[model samples]
Target: MFVDQEGPDPNFSAIAAVADGRATVTVTGEVDMSTADDMLRAAMTDDVAATTLDLRRVTFFDSAAIHAVLQLADFHGPKLTVLPSAQVRRVLEISGLAGQPWLSD
Candidate 1:
């Protein structure tokens, strides 16, 4: 289960979970300069297993973060849940992604 700490200062508070053989990562932050590695690791956790990323609460994103998300499609399929935010939706669309496994229900 991907755990995220509720409330303010969301950037440094989420956790990725790999359990019973699957992975779930809940990302809640402006994934940028300093947090790319953490996001990358969360995206690529536990040996290329199937993973679900709950990016519902992310307030901001950048190209590097998009690069990281796109990277996952290279080695593994992604199940991402997009919130009702247009900006967030644009991140996926602008990154040329938002179909099939990458855009999970």
Candidate 2:
């Protein structure tokens, strides 16, 4: 699926596609207050039964991003999987969310 953000800020983007009963969302650039909604919209479509978030390419992820992920997990249940980068993992660790079942190593 192709998700387009409201504005043209190339610094932040999220793309999603589905295969094998999983909606894989790859987010790039920064996911802050300005871009969190876009990322959420990209990842949490109507068909979010089995979602996998690929946050490996994300350079920056803040509380807003975490909030979005948590919201999606709440809506989608245990099927949410997250592939986080070192930076993303560090942030989740600092925030005490690294132990969450949805976040993967």
Candidate 3:
């Protein structure tokens, strides 16, 4: 699945794929209030044993994005893994979520 945002200073997109009971969501562009819901929706999948969020291409991330990630972690527990970009890392660090177990190296 692919999601594309329209009418924005920073564009956003998310692609989700499932294989072997695992879901992988690769998100590019910005993740903010305008795109957080889409990000969450893309990441959520039924019957998946685990989910990986690849945000290495994200150029912007905000509190809303953090909330979306937290919600995913709450739903997926230890099964959720997030690979954050540098932009995301900076915000996560400021939010004190950088040490979260769900954040992958």
Candidate 4:
């Protein structure tokens, strides 16, 4: 009767992975109430700019996701590139990242 936590929930099947040689994290899934923290933490890897977040397939986002974006900026240095979904972009904008030095795209 025990469940596992090592796997992603079906509803949040989307994955946020590093790409471009770990210089970027490609987010291809729903980053909402459940996956927000995971997404944010994923962006804290290395190089970051080499980290081009790919949110081309994200379907939804919430306040938690927005907060995560804000936190991500702190790690992105001056080359934080964001490939956010329409919704994710809006969130970043509101969090004051659109014009910040952390945003590259």
lDDT of each: 0.63, 0.85, 0.90, 0.64
lDDT of 1 at 88: 61
Least well predicted 10-residue stretch by lDDT in candidate 3: 1-10
Model 3, range 72-95, lDDT digits (tens) per residue?
Answer: 999899999999998899999999
Put the candidates in lDDT order, highest first: 3, 2, 4, 1
Candidate 2 error regions (>4 Å) = 1-9
Best by TM-score: 3
lDDT of 3: 0.90
In model 2, what are the clashing residue pairs, if there are any? none
RMSD, each candidate, Å? 7.2, 5.7, 5.0, 5.4
In candidate 1, stretches whose alpha carbon ends up further than 4 angstroms from where it belongs are 1-10, 47-49, 78-86
What are the clash counts of all predictions, listed in order? 0, 0, 0, 6
Model 1 per-residue lDDT tens digits across residues 1-105: 434354334455447888876677777767764565687787676563467766777777777667766676565754443332356677777767766466654
Write candidate 4's Cα lDDT for 1-105 as tens digits: 534454444555434465555555666666766677777776677643455556656776667777777676666655566676677677667766677654546
TM-score of each: 0.69, 0.85, 0.89, 0.64
Error of 2 at 72 (Å): 1.1
